[model samples]
Structures are given as structure tokens and as C-alpha cells.
Target: MYFFLINLSILDIGAISVTVPKSMTNSLMNTRSISYTGCVTQVFFLIFFVGTDFFLLTVMAYDQYVAICQPLHHERVMNRTACVQMAAGSWASGVLNSALHTGNTFAVSFCRGNKVDQFFCEIPQLLKLTCSDSYLSETGVILFSVSLALCCFVFIIVSYIQIISTMLRIPSEQGQHKAFSTCLPHLTVLSLLVCTAWFAYLKPLSSTTSQLDLVVSILCCLQ
Candidate 1:
């Protein structure tokens, strides 16, 4: 889980790095201009990492569920081979999802308009700028993105529900306390993720340029 989290952090850094430096440079120059290819690359890599993180988080939640709920078979169920397979599967799924989304995104030509509103290239934000008829692409992207997000959310919530229920079954108060304490770090990370993600994608896209958005973006990068 830690290894997967670290990879997600690095991918976040890469996504942020690709966009922030250019945005800062433009701000200094007072010209919000990004090259056509640069913008495409930015959107592609951003999608890649975001998808990758989603899969990584889902895998981590599953790992936690197994560790907490199936202690007797934890080692057998999550042996080194199984753990490696889970990691590989997450990585593979992320790559495929990212590629699919990115391909759909670029299928709609941008014409000559390269003025992106947000500091980073987001899917919805980019779609808004396309000159081509993007109804099909837009719908597909939204559904794809939402499905992954909802799946991750449901899995995480279900895992926690089972975890909490199991903890409540402990006979001793100290055992329950310890069990709950084990989840504190994961809970903190999940809260931050949900909050930042809500602001970034759930809220109005027009509001992403605010200071709050930047702070959230920065926080995500730090993770």
C-alpha cells in the first residue's frame, strides 16, 4: 500500500509539474498561452496519473480490508505473489483507462484555440474548449470518469463499513480502540482525497481557478 501510495504521489508530482511551471511562466510573462502539443501532452499525462491513483487507492482499500477482516488468512490471501499481482493489475488498469480517456479527449480537434482556463489541463475543462462536435466524446468521458470514481468510492466505503463493524465486534474496549486507531492514517488520507477531488471535479468547473483550488492542487501534489 505504501509503495502504491508513493507511486501515486510521484505521478501527481509529474502531472502538476507539467502544468504548473508553464502556468507560472505565463503569469510572469502576462500571456496565458500554451503550445498546442504541450496542452495535449499535459491533458494526456494528467488523465494517466489521475486514473492510476484511482486504481491504486482501490487496491489499497482492498488490501486493508483483507488485513483487518481476514487476519487468519491474511498471509495466505495476500502473499508476496498476490500482492505483486494486485499492484500490477492496478498499474495496468490505470494505463488502459488513461489511454482510453486521453484518446477520446484528443479525438475532438481543438482548432486554433489553445487557451486553457485552469492552471492544469482537466478533462472537462479541455472538452469545453474544443471546436469540434464533442457530444459523443464528452458523454463517454464523463461516464468513464464517473464510473471509476464511483467504484473507488463504493469500494472504499464498503471496506470501511466492514472494518468498523468488525472492530465493533471486538470484546475488549482496548482492542476496539486499537483497531480503530489502525484506520486513522488511512481515514485521513481518504478524507483529503475526497475533499480535494470534490472540489476539483465535483464542483462547478468555472470555480477551479480560485485560491482554494490551487491549495487543493498543491495538497494533492504533496501527497
Candidate 2:
């Protein structure tokens, strides 16, 4: 799992780097602007890292489930080659997904003013800038991404359910406690990830930005 954790840490850093530095520079310069290319770059890398991290979390769930529920096969199934393949697959998937969203998003004409509602070039906020019909393709992209995410979420849930069942079969209460402690934190993190993202992309759009949007965007970066 350390391998997966390392990948997760890298993704987290990438996610933050994509958005935070531009915001910090703007703050220091007392400017509230980003170039067209800069905004596009932000949208691409932000989506890339975010999508990869979500996939990594799902992989981590499978790792934990194998390690705890089927300890005997864990080493054989999650060998170094397998781990590398999984990590590489996750990164590739992220890049492909990011490319899709970024291309679809920028394909539309931004008839509305260029001012973004949130701190970063979030897809939803970017979509808001487009003319109504111009954004339909981007909206469809978001729906596709959400559906993919839902599949990952369901896989995570199933893994955890099996993990919990295995933990319950432990004879010792102390053993069960130890196992539960290890798994609960991961579950909590997944819960937070799902909740924040669901509220974020699925929430109602507005003509004016909400303070909550700013707060949530900050929280997303901090993740």
C-alpha cells in the first residue's frame, strides 16, 4: 500500500500545484486575472490529477481489501508488476479523461464575460461562461465523468463491505478492533472525497459566485 500511497501523495501535490500557485501569484500581485492559456492549463492539469487521485483511491481500496480479506493471495495478486500496471493505468486514464473534458470545454464559445466564479479554472465554472447551447457538449462530458466516478465509488463500496465482513469473522475482539481502526480512516477519507466532489460538481449553478464555492474550492485544493 505504500506504493499506492506514494502515488496518491504525488497526485495530491499535483492537484494543489495546478491551482494554488496561480492563485498565490494573483494574490501577491493584487491581480484577479489569469491568461487564456494559463486558465486552460489549470483546467487540464486540475482535472488530470483529480481524476487520477479518485482512481488511486479506488485502487487503494482494492489493495486494502486484498491484504485484509485474502491475505494469502495478496502478495501474489498485488505484486510489484501488478501495482505498477495499476498505477500507470490510473495515470493514463486521468490524462485521457482530462483531455476529453478540456477539449470539450474549450470547444464552446464563451459569450459570457471571462471572469471565473471560483479560484481555479474549474470545469463547472468554466461551463458557466459559455453561451447556453455552446456548453451542452461540456455538460455531457461532465455527465460522462460523473458516471465513471460513480462506478469507481460503487467498486470502493463493495470492497469495503467485503473488508468489513472479513473483519467481523475475526475471533478476537482486540483483533477486530485493530482491523477496524485500520479500515475506518480510509473509509472516512473516501466519504469526504465523495461528499465534497458530489456537492461541488452537482450543485446548482448561479449567476453570482457563492462564498461556499470559494470555501469548497479551497477545500478541494487542500485535499
What C-alpha lDDT, on a 0 to 100 scale, does residue 57 get in candidate 2?
88
Candidate 1 RMSD to the real structure: 2.8
Tens digit per residue, CA lDDT, model 1, 153-206: 998999989998888888999988887777787788777877877777676557
Name the runs in model 1 displaced over 4 angstroms.
24-31, 203-223
Reference-based lDDT, each prediction: 0.74, 0.88
Model 2: how far is 3 from its true place, Å?
0.3
Error of 2 at 147 (Å): 0.8
Models 1 onward score TM values of: 0.83, 0.97
Q: For residues 112-184, write the lDDT of model 2, one tens digit per residue.
A: 8988877778888888888878988888888899899999999999999999999989999998998888778
Residue 22 in model 2: lDDT: 88
How many residue pairs collide in each prediction?
Answer: 0, 0
TM-score of 1: 0.83
